[model samples]
Target chain A: MKSAKAKAHTNIALIKYWGKKDPKLFLPMNSSLSLTLDAFYTETEVILDGNLEMDQFILNDEIQGEAETTKISNFLNLFRQETGILTPAKVTSQNFVPTAAGLASSASAFAALGAAMNEVSGMKADPTTLSTFVRRGSGSATRSVFGGFVEWQMGTCNEDSHAIQIDDASWDIAMVTVAVNTGKKTISSRQGMQLTVDTSPFYASWVETAATDLVDIKQAIRNQDFQQLGEITESNGMKMHGTMLGARPPFTYMEPTTIDVLAAVRQLRQQGFEAYYTMDAGPNVKVLCHLSDSEKIQMKLKEAFPNNPVIISKVGGGIELLS
Target chain B: MKSAKAKAHTNIALIKYWGKKDPKLFLPMNSSLSLTLDAFYTETEVILDGNLEMDQFILNDEIQGEAETTKISNFLNLFRQETGILTPAKVTSQNFVPTAAGLASSASAFAALGAAMNEVSGMKADPTTLSTFVRRGSGSATRSVFGGFVEWQMGTCNEDSHAIQIDDASWDIAMVTVAVNTGKKTISSRQGMQLTVDTSPFYASWVETAATDLVDIKQAIRNQDFQQLGEITESNGMKMHGTMLGARPPFTYMEPTTIDVLAAVRQLRQQGFEAYYTMDAGPNVKVLCHLSDSEKIQMKLKEAFPNNPVIISKVGGGIELLS
Candidate 1:
């Protein structure tokens, strides 16, 4: 068996995916849009050989436990089954981004893994096909397989529910990520999504509105309307968090730093800077702005949160086979 | 001219009123439910005299500014119109609760003023009519006119939209108010409500779900189901905040200490204390639990927030006039 290595960058959702229509199949309830970023990425190497007795997984040079390895093994099994390769695989992965901190590290992780596994197994699947395969491991990873602007369509079936590139995102759009909390969250996105879906009274409305937002955002992207895009992105992200707030025994992911960053972003906008912010299921906030103003926005955010890591990223490319 | 004094206690909404269908009339877009608390209240004295040049308003032993005086003057004018009394009035009010910061001080303030105005004008309006009059000043004040559990019905017109007692709340229900922030909020309730109504995409859904929550909670109150009531109360409060989150240039009222109090409440529930928390438009959180557990919850909250004020209150009575 041949070994393959690949790298893929993380993507931040402009329109979030909050709930699963079919948890077992990993089908989302609403379509989502995202902007793939260059600042954070994951690289993975995979080797399939008959000599391997069991699958092995290593993350960031540390050996993973059975639970973590088992997840990776199951994901590889999808590619193995497709290519009729019964040999166990050894996978090594490294992340440049903060893992499990609402930064969409999984988007890069699974996207790279899928690309590497596909190459090792000689599947030679196209990007769209690879996205469908990677989505089984992480839903947002489907968008990471494409470059720049991507949209994941929440189709009725597994075969149809795949992501596609919407734009090259070669325009002036960029993001300033404020890493407020790099620590792992108490609740995972998977667990949080399930809780919101099962208990939130606003879940149905979230699904409906997210679809509308998806449509509006796509139009804004097509027109290169930065203001409209930023507005919808901010609104969509809040709607996703809103659903979580309405969940039973309601919880919020926002910390004081999250609010502070948001206030700073608002202040920046008031100062004539065209900046808007969006957050995932953690304390970190990502400020969307024009590429030309990214440095100034970063400076303002750094002044407000002097201790936190503030990084600026432009649009990134899709998964690539390194060697 | 004869002067009359009346007192009314503050009431915190379990199902919140987020927006108004008619801003001019102070009519809410959704029905809301609240619990009248014994710990916080306001007293006001009103006197209508033909010799008075204009309305004079004093609050907490200090002369109020023109804005506050004008608000009180306009509220008294409602009674003037009803009773055909052209004379201006002198209104003096004092609060037992923290004045803003989500303590629902406006509930008690306007309820007391309405009761006093009703008596001085010789309108002799019933509690329901007085509630409607008070609602024009503050929406939550409509519920404050009644003792125990009250529901403000979101009627189509001003004549029909009023508060009525849902339960006398003679049961063991009580609240431990954690005054996390007593200072005035940067965003007032009136301004926040307008922003949410005009900007939030989820505002309509908030109205719809709040109506349903009101129904479910009223039934829970009737059955005296503590767990159900607490669950609905917590969910409703979160839903209200959720709408605020989705507002354009989104904002949240939750502070770091507010989240700390919420976590403590959840911890108490996890430890089988049957405690649940609800917040208004500020950082303070009110833990709803059995009257038997109020002291214990208070102790735990005090331990968690050593510096903040923690007060326990049971079911309070309706507005009453003094001779």
Candidate 2:
């Protein structure tokens, strides 16, 4: 087959995916689903070049660091070994998230990368198949392959666990992301989850209960019930943090400003605005508001927190090839 | 009425009492209550002595600090005005639990003081009356006036809200308290609660939901269902901490050692032991195990944490005058 290139965009989980049952296999403790926003996504291009010494990866216009680079390289190496491609391959990527101040952008970035790579390799693969490759890259990234509303099926094995598109999210739901990156994080999510797995008393409880919430949240999204979705996501995120609090040393990912943003969101909700927020590993605030009311909500939040500029976007589509 | 002396005790809520509608009147936003355990308790003896110039307060064998002394003296001044009592009173309190250890010993201690003072003043008052007086001293202290399974009614006015006993633990449940006083607390519960009320989005959520849980937990206790009660208390405590974590600067009462103790408790539970822990504002672990199984739970915890000594006690009764 002739060499080809494919560009794919990333996605984000409004209902965050956390807590893995098996970290080695990236088996999630619960099934988490999300949406693919048009804004704040990754654009990845895969080139099948048989002349390279080794498979190459360039993230966001820069060469990946030793540790991170090795991870991506290993993923590519494994893929190459499976395909029996004796010659190496090369991959290039660029993340369009300006400084990307949190909100699990890497999930979408890598998932998009996997989708683009699979397509360029002449593979007629579905999201689940694409997810298998992304899972080797990052667990949450597996969910980014499908657009609209997507679900990460946390199966028992690598063959079964994958991402599937749930809905197109072509409705009036709006998302506003606020970037807040102060400096280096005290602890990474990897370390936090590991600590929770090793030390938290409620880890089992979390794993047991999260599936129910995730299922309910997916149904809520399908129903386009913003209130239900928001409430469940808020509770699910808090419960995940609850497990973190029970972890040894108990590191909290929430920042003082994040609390302020959440308070503002609740205040907006109380003021008859259908607004809710979900957070990931960063200090940024992403609000799920209605498109019709987005401007007003954004203006009020902007007035209150003029220092933090909010980026507004509607429901985004799934990963696709560059025309 | 002749001048006399009497002793009293107060109860402390594991779920905190926060956001007073009226701080001076000590009107809480919601009703809170707790069990007045036998092992860690407070004793207060009050003397109606005309010889004293004013009502003097002593805690843990030391004269009250300047700020605390002022706060108490002001409360007493108000009480005396309301009671129309001419003679000055003296209050002495001894806490079985250590100071600044996150245990709400002060709550029970102060409640007992109010009861004892009322008795010595020739005011033969019921628990309701005692709760009113104690509420003025500290919102949580009023709950300590009742023995087992007490609920503090968040009364709107001075007449309606007070602590009431739901049920006396004639049942078989026991609590093993692990007192870990690493050092003086960096944040007092009062300050922490204030921060939470002012900053946390979950604060309103907690305030709205606590009453329901409070009622449900009371029912759980009445049925003598250790599993239900343990689950409810742990969840309630977690909900309470949720607000704290969402607070600005996010003060955590959870120490590393506290996590260790919690893991030990859960490990024991997994081993088919009837043990679950509920934590208040401190780093200590209060394992709510069955009275029949206290020794085994304690031994298991001791095995996990050799440095800390666990005190196992059955459901303790309310305070009484030491004859």
User: In model 1, what lDDT does residue A296 have?
Assistant: 90
Which window of ten consecutive residues has the lowest lDDT sum in model 2 chain A? A1-10
Candidate 1 Cα misplacement greater than 4 A, ranges: none
Q: Which run of 10 residues does model 1 chain A get worst, by summed lDDT?
A: A254-263
Supply the global lDDT for candidate 1. 0.89
Which candidate number would show the highest DockQ if scored against the true structure?
Answer: 1
Instruction: For candidate 2, write residues A102-213 as lDDT tens digits.
Output: 5566676676667666656555566677787788778778877767788888887888898888877777887887655535566666777787677655566566656777
The clash count for each model shown is 0, 8
lDDT of 1 by residue, A50-115 (tens): 798999999999999999999998898898789898788889999998998999899999999999
TM-score of each: 0.94, 0.60
List pairs with backbone clashes in candidate 2. Answer: A38-A316, A147-A318, B8-B112, B9-B112, B10-B108, B10-B144, B11-B144, B155-B161
lDDT of 1 by residue, B57-144 (tens): 9898999899989888888888878888878888888899898889989999999999988888889898987888999998999999
Q: What is the fnat value (0 to 1) for candidate 1? A: 0.58
Worst 10 residues of 1 chain B by lDDT: B200-209
